[model samples]
Target: MKIDGSALIAARQKLRANFPGRGEIGSPSIGTQEWLAEQAHVSIRALQYLERGEGSLSNLKKVCTALGISQWQQLIINYGEDYVSCIANRFVDFRPSIYPPENPETFANSSLLMTLDPLTLLVAKGKFETILLQEVNATLTGLAEPITYTWLAEVSLTPNGQGWLGWVKEVEPMNLLANDVPMNVPIMFKQLCVPQVSWGAFVDAVENLTTSQLNIEVCLIFQNFTKKFKVYVSVDLLKILFNEGRNKYLSPLPYRAQLKAIV
Candidate 1:
């Protein structure tokens, strides 16, 4: 994953110039190059190379931390625009609108897609995974019959050091209410090891959950890691169930995130 060098340099200069110094913070701030080098604990040459977008990922990470940049995604989100060619499509593939027109005659409305915040799973270092299970509880009151529904999550995992990788075991569609059955379909289950790149799996369990169809719980379990972590995204489909598909057009996209460990 690459970042815009010019953006990095601009951010660094702006921050360094505005940093508290002398009477402002009761201590004098050092020169830009020297201060950044000391804070990041790296050579001045290394910082210069990174400012030009010609440094290693390790050095970039260090400098970014020194600049109060908590996550790499921050750089991409703040500076990813106008430098799309330098970054991967999977890392920054986001749009404000993906809704179809009103007339169903032109659009089949077979599928809807969404992108969430980048996910990082910290399996080592004792960092716990952030679990978010959102249940779409809506009724299909006004729509055509035989409404078969399906879902899928496309994810990408990049490990940091020698961390062992883990994958999505299975997706269970449960009845959030009483003992009501969500849909006519059976249980949805699948298992596969996720590679470094993107991998997508569809939940072929329920066609239609009627009114009680809700709750899709997915658990990502990480075993162990020394200095490894994982980062990825969750791409979900938007199949609005109530109010004549008005909910899908309400928001840009639903957001969900996963975290990684740093042990």
Candidate 2:
């Protein structure tokens, strides 16, 4: 999966030569190192390494993406066998199937997620049960009209102790699902779960039954939100709200503070 240095250099040179007025490897405009770095989603320094034909498999793929080359392996063919590298195609052999709704299940990877307004849910008219709640309620706690904000929540059902427990992380805008309506404030979520359920009715008894991350192999995917999908979030981080962030968790919320400190 990794690219040979000579191959990358040669490929880049060929691409540059195709452009009008393109001269050097790091010339002005499209040929600039900075521009290429942006396209590859790497830093200026990383681009320097890329030009030398040295980078990890992930970076090589990024470079391929920037250069608009679909056959990433082709980059290696030009480098001669000495620089050519290969890795097992694990994804081709393993992809989890969607779970049946008749029984509960969990997933092995993450999927895309987004926030929704309860009022919007009302208008949409679907089956939305409050599965799990933390310190705050899923609906606004009696906030009058012009209720600009509400808590983002995680809901789920546990059947026989082997149910789907989802893990989520809000993804960046560029990582949003292709061609989906981007969210407003706090947007899309990357969810990880298993194909445990499909179109099955949830027993009222399990509505409040808290599900744990037990007996489940996770599956991940970056998906757009649909009326059919449900949201599952960590209790501590689900306080995502617009402008005034659910207001239930005080300012400098634990999650926000931790994120800021890390960043």
TM-score of each: 0.26, 0.25
Residue range with the least summed lDDT across 10 consecutive positions in model 1: 196-205
lDDT of each: 0.34, 0.32
Cα deviation at 105, candidate 2, in Å, is 85
Candidate 2 displacement at residue 137 in angstroms: 74
Expressed as tens digits, the lDDT of each residue in 1-263 for candidate 2 is 23445655666667666665634555545645666677788887876775665666677788778877665653442222222111111110101123323212432121212222111111111212111111111111111111121223332212432233221332222222112222232211122224321111111111222542111111111111112222232222222221132154342211111011000
- The segments of candidate 1 whose C-alpha lies over 4 angstroms from its true place after superposition are 19-31, 73-263
Residue range 189-251, candidate 1, lDDT tens digits? 222213211111111211233432222222322111012122232222222222223354452
Q: After superposition, how far is residue 24 of candidate 2 from its true place, in Å?
A: 14
- Candidate 2: where is the Cα deviation over 4 Å? 18-28, 74-263
